[model samples]
Target: MKKIIILFVAVLLLASCENQEKVNKKADISTITAESITQVINELNASNSGIDKFLMEKGVKHVANLWRDSDGSEEEFKAFCKKNYIADVTERELVFQKISRNIEIITGNFNKITLELLEPVHLNTFEQHAIDNEFGAYSVDSHWMNDFYQNKIAFIIALNFPPFSLEEKEANAKEWTRKQWAYARLGDYFTARVPAELLQEAGKAAANSDVYIMDYNIHVGHLTDAAGNRFFPEDKVLLSHWNLRDEIKANYANTNDGLEKQKMIYQVMQRIISQEIPEKVINNGKLEWDPYTNMVYENGKTIEATPEPNERYQQILNNFHANKAIDAYYPDQNTFIKRQYDGAKEISAEATEKIFTDFLRSDETKKVGALIKQRLGRDLEPFDIWYDGFKARSGMDESKLDAQTRKLYPNAVALEADLPNLLVKLGYDKERAQWLGDHIAVDPARGSGHAWGGAAKGQKAHLRTRISEKGMDYKGYNIAVHEFGHNVEQTISLYDVDNFVMNGVPNTAFTEALAFIFQKRDMLLLGITDDSPQKEALKKLDLFWSAYEIMGVSVLDIRMWKWLYENPEADATQLRDATMQIAKEVWNEFYAPVYGVKDQTILAVYSHMLNSPLYLSNYAFGNVIEFQLEQQLKGKSFPTEVDRIFKQGRLTPNQWMVEATGNDLSATPLLNAAKEALEELK
Candidate 1:
């Protein structure tokens, strides 16, 4: 077991890009003076260099740190910052030098079109400000279901560069249509998340929550669930979070070779992930989240990463087990891609196969031993096993999480049934409460994981971006709690701030703070506690286990990208070998000492490496912030205090954390916290 818990690529937040459905709707905000709106929209979009050169990059210490060095390691960061003279944020100064604002009116126009499409439960829009274009302000005034997937797809559309194989103009055009269709489908999923909430408690009654979401129709055009009409959907419901993904994959899988391309991409990624072929790997994909990644498999097999290396690989592998950051770059090699991947050894196939065979022996499969084929079929790809397997391991039934969440939050449609409740709980009331919740949770679906959308306050409409998690589990629920926390924060900040457009928080990490506040409730929500000494021990285990798991994987993500950039033309086998070498190196360094495992890349079972790129950093960021906030919230009577922290959306993560915890985003807080908890284990 390694440290990392969450998986996937570079995700900050959407820069409010456009999602074109090829149809425009006139909004009711005609009285607000279109000329004035157009001027502001044009100003934001027309800058030549954008906010006077890296308006997105100014004072961006935290964001800067995440991308500090090409190496993507702790040492590289220190050296890079020292060399570049980058300044970390101070405790008192609320610096958000890098919160991105899409100056392109096209981005604003995209929001406007989305706003006009809202219906049913309109989010409060009048009191809250929103980014408006020549068309109208993107209001979160009405119920819009398919918001999650839309924003996720939109974010991709906005950042996706032309494929190396395709023409730039053609690529952009294709991306435009791709964004629109993805958004159109995502609207369906939001309805799914809500309906799932409603159905969880539908019970024998006619006016149950299922009736609520079914009435909402999360996946608009499809009007169905992944499990089908008879499943959660026909029950007049869809489950939130977990099941919501089922709907998207089942319902909206792209037909025009899009989803297939994604599948191929994931399959090829297995070379990096499972086979560990590349020896040394790095992503020049320049995809959203780029991480330096590496891989090594221990079938009791040995590959000499460096010359004159015999038991040295064993020593490094042992150190890697310990999670100590070794400054060795593995350099370049003629015989091998990197010093690590250059080895002249290989683990026997039988030993590696033995390990996998044992995993298959678990009681997880119902058909049992008859299933010798672990990588079953196309549907049962190796990655599917990782995803589905872990899901089954989670005590909760994959189908039941949403049903259970609904039972927890009644009197409202979903957990976020009404965004304003978060504000109201935080101490705001009536107009202020309604204004933010309805607006923020209801913004047009811009692509990005867990992006909270808001319409102008007082106006009635709703929209929500996707809270992304496909191969996620109990951890994903924690992530969902955090995402919901962001939604709550978006609700409050948009409602509270003066400038509707500038009302919300800046950067992806602020909402992360809000989510962290909520995720602590994992054990609390489960009604478990550090009661018995045994239970307390278990709690510590979960943290260290997740962290240990994630860290190695994070190491792989970074190493792989670095390899790719360095070896642009490494064939597929070469890619697999490179990744394997790094994975082995990371495992040896991080986990070997702690768990006493000789070699384990089990944590590499992350989907992010398959899909979203360079994204593992945020989980590290989230863990850091969560630990920092937990330290502050420990003895404080922060009952509704969490809400106030959330409402300060767009405050810039660095500034928000400073205000919330009087600190900057750093690993020390988490490291310290983990150490304390580990001491309890002692």
Candidate 2:
């Protein structure tokens, strides 16, 4: 109001001056002091921030649309800068044509985003930029990549796995496991290599942004969730998954030089579903375990046995064991993705008992029948499903019982500023932690509560986040942990890229490896551990079990889609049928063999298929690497030695594994974690 009043008075004074030229001269001649200029800049940003956000979103859409073949002849809308131009004399209109003739990737000739253009560019400096530009959307792409690949190659050299050149393929279990882990780790390394040059170019462009605003588009545009939608996230799943075919899952099935990651991973899968600790899986003595593979054979005489250790069960496991679906994607035991799989699981509704007493057994929910009648509350809507989940987590902060995180890192300008100190506490040294401190920035923007991505442009990179905000109450905090992993990579890669092109990891999972590392920080933050609290045991079980749950869904995603592709005749209905069958198959193999669960399709609620193509694997990968990194940090601190390791930017994923943990990123961490949990349960 005061500003408006002042403006009105200024306008009146200007109006009283009969000459417009004089007013213009006065406005231009008046010099603003530095403090006033800073104030104005802040105020202007506060007012125009919405418009800026709107433009960024539109820009992202524009970039996504540019990947399409515009008219079937490999022509795309925005594959390159528009150059041909002409002007009309009287109307002052400009006419132009785009330069998009040579690009084939945008025309869909390739489905993955591998920087294949640079695969052969090793040793040649002059022609390297050529390949980088071809693979990158911008020019500096080569600069970032050249350095990134070197680190990957160096790491691979150290691992000393025998190379597979599509020739000498057969290998033993141990050999195959080594190969599977390497390929899985390297797929991202090479893929990220392709974009190294692109990001390098992007950073350069970002630096000269103000002068090039008209030509360039936006960088980090996010979307708003619709009333019935939170179904998607910033479309990040898609963006992150965009070039997956060339990255992590390129040779997804044939893990070790075409031997098979599925087979290696599957070896343990069998143990999880059927291995027990001396008791049968029973729900009130009911015997509902599947009897397919759980049989006994003595001296060539076969006997149908109860589901037990060392026995296989059902079609999914049987098929996997037999190499039928060995190539399938299975993230966990309980949840697997099959397009048609109606995967579901059960949990107790917190208010079920109260609802049943009032006889308000409407169509709300079988569990919560009385909330509407007894307490005047509404029906058990599906949206309220997470009420119990959030409450369980947020309940920790019943009072202002927590200290402000900023107190720990007084040097930090934001909450993210606290990351270094926290890292040191968890195990980082002060200097490296401070170096990390310098690279990150906390935006305080309303993030969906995930740690969010870090953007690196020019010599500096900044990390921005919107944690501790609305809707971010607890779930957001959990996500904040996971996101921190992503931002750490962003900070490391952007600020510490080897040659600028080789400055970051090779793929989403490479960053995921780090984010996975950071996410473990939450328990560290609360000072909780293996012996912390009674509830921690249950929470840990939920965490450990949830990974198993997701493993099934992840497998379903890989398998069902391949099934659909195999059976082109199948529609949505056919797809769903095959999916449900796979779900039940998996349940019988893992859960039924132990917990006795069946016909559960709750896994379908996962948003990946609706948004991303091959993201389920990342969660599984995170769990896997979490084990590796945690082992590395188990006794030592991070900032003392790890932050520099994290800051090493362009290390191929494997190199990072060796440098950070002195081992390969593998299933051992997670497998050990699970094994430990099982032992405790005993």
Candidate 3:
């Protein structure tokens, strides 16, 4: 799932033809002095005796900071605040309701329009044209912020609904009512006034990177060894990083040629990371190539091949520059990292980092690693970070599972049809399950599947799952189930929540938690039940091990972003080297002791680094939340409990966790369960 930018809600009203003179003048607004802020506040307070000093100070400062010379002089700023400021609690609440309702209508419609416009780029039904690509990158709402500022809609919001810091929300949220929460969320709407062109450029960079990743497919059958021996079937094709990694995991039970296939996939990943992968070998099955030797051949004749020229790192560089450009607009949460955490996620980066670091460095991680080694009867390799032995399906042949899945879900429609049945299998009532299923639409994805939640109440949440022409294979089915979980969350949170302003979960991690819950039951939905007495124990270990691996990747992602901020002028090559070093350092510190290996760059191979940008951490956070929810729902009704919990809607992470599980987000439960599971297995 892409990280939703909540602030975009305020900026989705851009006019088609912006006044360039006004925009040019507004550029000097950042130069507004501290004395100017004080002057506006004192003058406004002096005139408005009904308004409190706190409100006067906050409203004036927020408005003045965004006040351009073109907007008006300081006198006009004071007059606007004095006239618009609502002093009565009841009156202010009425104003909040009106603004919130209007925003929902505007943002919801804009979201629908944007989603429809990008269908050509997002879906793979036809060859995307140059115009389609450009259209996809062109954000219709990019100029909305500029338009809002020019028309004083943004200032009205700032003046009436003063923003709260994340800390303030956390500290006061417990005592706040539903209306108060809605008001606070409204405050979140207009904190920053980024230039429309910068937002458009950022969108373009993201769209281009997304296109690059979506098209990055490798012809597995065309892969040749140093001895010119083909291992995979002629028809097999896999997307870089996702399917390739899944293929490696799927082969752990293949005693005949699985290890060799795993080795080859690892080689391909290394080539990709080092930018030494053959350019022609990507998404092209017309040429035969030896990944290990970096050689290409056509019709049994040698062919020269060029490397990919660091295009992967170039995408990351573009995202970094684009995000960096907007830093100035966000004075409080200046960096992308800060905005992702404090603004969107409502969780501090430092807190999440500590949680991950503590878990990765724990002795429980070593116990799970040792258990994996014992299960494999061999030393762990870098690729073993994705070890699949803990999964029940690991013992079964992937082909048999794939055959079953293919037969059951022959197309996207088949899976969509069965969503209610799958939900029922997880203990949801038939009626509610059917209702949820009706709100979800499944589509074939061009790349690895992702779930896109509907922005409006009636809009259907889309589950874009990758389905081969042959059918939905086991790996694709597994991912579809995971994405189905996202759709379910999206549907429930949007349609069932009490307030439209508080429709979604707190952050992506919360939805990811629900997705993990649904994903762990994929086998149950397939009528494959494990009656092992140690089933619960195995589940605990699985969650622990998965969390352990992703936490390392998450740390690496955070460090990479920090590195990018430090080296603003660094090119793609420099960034790549620095990324590799950071990945190795993270592995050596946290993973080497457990895996008995050092200096591995495999942790840096996640495709999100290039495309999603700082999203990998949510997976780790999701695992933690999933484990806590799992513990709470041990004997509870799955659907009832899920609905009860998720409908709480957009609280701070800790507060939401406390309401759902009676505790804050912690790794101790998982760690404790892993310890017990290890003992039981022994």
Predicted structure with the largest TM-score when compared to the true one: 3
Model 1 misplaced stretches (Cα beyond 4 Å): 1-106, 112-272, 275-403, 406-436, 440-449, 455-480, 493-506, 522-545, 571-573, 637-640, 643-656
Task: Compare the candidates by lDDT and give the number of the best one.
Answer: 3
Error of 2 at 530 (Å): 7.8
lDDT, model 1: 0.35
- TM-score, cand. 1: 0.41
The RMSD of every model to the true structure, in order and in angstroms, is 22.4, 26.9, 5.0
Encode model 1's per-residue lDDT on 1-682: one tens digit a residue.
2343333211211211111111122111112233433433343335422232222222122222113122244443333323332122231111111111221233344455554533222222222222222113122212232232233322221111111111222233224342322222221112111211112111112112112222221221112122222112222222322233333333222234323323333333343245332322121111111111222212323223311122212222222211111111111122112212111111112322232223222222222111213322233222222222111123334345544444544322344554555445444666766644455433312221244354445433233332222222343344455565666665566555433334555444455555656655544554544445544333333333334344446556666666665765555556555766777776565444333344444445354443333345445445555556666766665544665565543333445576666776455444444445545644
Report the lDDT tens digits of candidate 3 across residue range 1-682: 3454866644543431342443444453554578767766677667666766775577767787778777877667666777777767788878777876777777878788887777787776657776777777888878876888899988888887778788888899789888778777777878888887888878989988888988899999999998888889999999988999999999999988888899899988988988889898899999998888888999988998999988999999999988887776777888999999888888788888998999888888888888888888888888888888887888889889999999999998999999999988889889998999999998888888899888877789999878888999999999999999899889888888887888898999989998998888888889999998988899889888889989999999999999999999999899989999999999999999998878888888899999999999899989989999988898988888988998888888888899999897787888888999999999
Q: Rate the local accuracy (lDDT) of all candidates.
A: 0.35, 0.36, 0.85
lDDT of 2 by residue, 1-682 (tens): 1245878889767753533333334322212233433343344345443333322232222222222122112222122211110112222111000111111122212212222332222112224343343343333233433343343332222122122222122222124433243332222222111223223333333222211111111111111112211111222111111111111122222223321222221221232233321114211122112122332233334434443332211222222222222112111211223211211111111111121212111221221223212321323221121122211232243112123332332221445656677667766567867776666554432212233333324222333333331222223343455666676677666555433333455345556656756664565664654444444333443344434555656665565556654664544445546766775665455444333345544344343543344356556545555556655765664644455565554333445567666786555445455445444544
Q: Measured by TM-score, how close is model 2 to the native structure?
A: 0.41
